[model samples]
Target: MSLLEVSDLRTYFYTEGGIVQAVDGVDFSVNAGETLGIVGESGAGKSVTVRSLLGLIDPPGTVVDGTITFDGQDLHSLTESELRREIRGSEISFVFQDPMSALNPVYTVGSQIAEVVEHHTDRTATEAWDRAVELLDDVGIPDAAVRADQYPHEFSGGMRQRVLIAMALSCNPKLIIADEPTTALDVTIQAQILDLFEEIQDRYNTGLIYVTHDLGVVREVCDRVAVMYLGEVVERGRYEDLFNDPKHPYTQMLMRSVVTPDRPVSSLDPIEGAMPSAVDPPSGCRFRTRCPVAIDDCSTIEPPDYAVTSDHAAACLLYDDDFAGDPPVLHERTTGGGRDE
Candidate 1:
């Protein structure tokens, strides 16, 4: 069985205006020692989906339906206290995007990590401190022992990220959810952090859920890719399959926008139209409003995930065999001209 399986998960916020369906009917899985990247635009519900998995959604927001099974244990069945005591930190951990806000300015880095270790494991305070230093060293932090005593401000952006990673590793959790962990760092530093994540995953044999809008970052780290739109997973498959042969129009647009080394800056074609608001998302397929290949049925009937291959699936009317018309071709705009696919 997979290490984590999320089925038709739905998380909605009861706002004064209306219900904002942040995560509506999402499904995915992560295997042991595998990295699954959830990629999408800002309002695609990538972060909210991961937060829902950990039962971290606050007041007004509720996980109204679906099952999140981790190692055969349904996470939704556990109470807040039960999740905190048994599941969170010990069984699964989270690494947030911004290290500056994640780490407390008042506390030394080592103490922060040690606190989690002490709370989640049988290690004594002293033993936890030692483990914290070891974790810092493992994540490639220099002068680990001395740096451990320093405050969050004392470390650089990359170092602070490493510290957060160390804290995530404190309890030796089976799964780690890193939500855009490299977003705030420089390109060079981002590469280092991504490398560290891969190393940690390999060394610990832990399942990893990497949430990021950067498809480039996903290409470097993730084994499988799930592309979310508005609040649903529109497509999912092996990274190579999804990257090389995107079956969904949104995914194709995302690929066309990627700044590859060979592709000039002028070749980038941004997708038109903003994402529909979650409060009242577009009916039928949420992406139909912006989909280049959207058909008449796409505006009225939601397309179920259709199999593009045994392992690849996409939710689009274009993939339906019963559709008689020719599929709309996407044109990649270039500097001099447009290339039709």
Candidate 2:
């Protein structure tokens, strides 16, 4: 079984405007030792999905429906205390976007790391400190002994990220959810961090859910990729299949925009139009407004998932039953017929 299985997960925010369905009917699973990249635009629900798994959403936000099963146990069914003491850090860890905000500024980086070990395990302060230092060393931080004494501000953005990673690994979690982990770093540092994730996953056999808006990073670190549009996943396939041939309109548009070093400067084509608001996303297919091949029916009826191959699938009317010829056919049919009630 997969290490983490999320089915029909819906995260909604009860705002004054209305209910904002941040993550609607999302389903995916991450197997042990595998890396799954969730790629999308800034407001496409990638963060909300992972945050819900950790029960971080509160007050205005709620996991309205569905199940989040981690290691055969339903996370939503666990008590708050049970989740914090048994699930979080112990079985699952998170590497957030910005270490500056994630790590307590008042505390030294070493203490933050030590606290995780101390809280999760029956270790004394000194033992936890030693383990924290060892974890820092494992993630390639030099002079771990002295660096552990430094504050978060004392480290560079890259180094701070490394420290956060160390903290995430302090408990040797089976799964790690990294949400835009390299966003604040430079290109060189981003590459280094991605390499670190690959190395750690290989060595520790940890399941990873790497969430980012940057498709380039996804290509580098993911075994399989899922592309989300608005609040739903529109496309998913193996890395090679996704990059080489994207079936969904949104995924194809994303591929065209990737700033790969090998690509010609003129070949980079950015997808136009901002994502629709989650409070009232576009009717039918949420991505229809921006999709080039969007038909009248696309805005009217939600497209059913179509199998491009044995392992690859996409949600778009282009491959729906209305289209003639092949099972994996792509056609341009214009009609905005089915609108969500």
RMSD of each: 3.4, 6.1
Query: Looking at candidate 2, what is the lDDT of residue 204?
Result: 96
Candidate 1 ranges with C-alpha deviation above 4 Å: 331-341
User: Could you tell me every candidate's TM-score relative to the true structure?
Assistant: 0.95, 0.93
lDDT of each: 0.91, 0.87
Give the per-residue lDDT of model 1 (tens digit) for 172-217.
8999999999999999999999999999998999999999999889
Model 2's C-alpha root-mean-square deviation from the true structure amounts to 6.1
Highest TM-score model number: 1
Model 2 stretches with alpha carbons more than 4 Å out = 325-341
Please write out the lDDT profile of model 2 over residues 54-130, one tens digit for every residue. 88898799999989889999999988889898889889999999888888988888899999899988999999999
Error of 2 at 178 (Å): 0.5
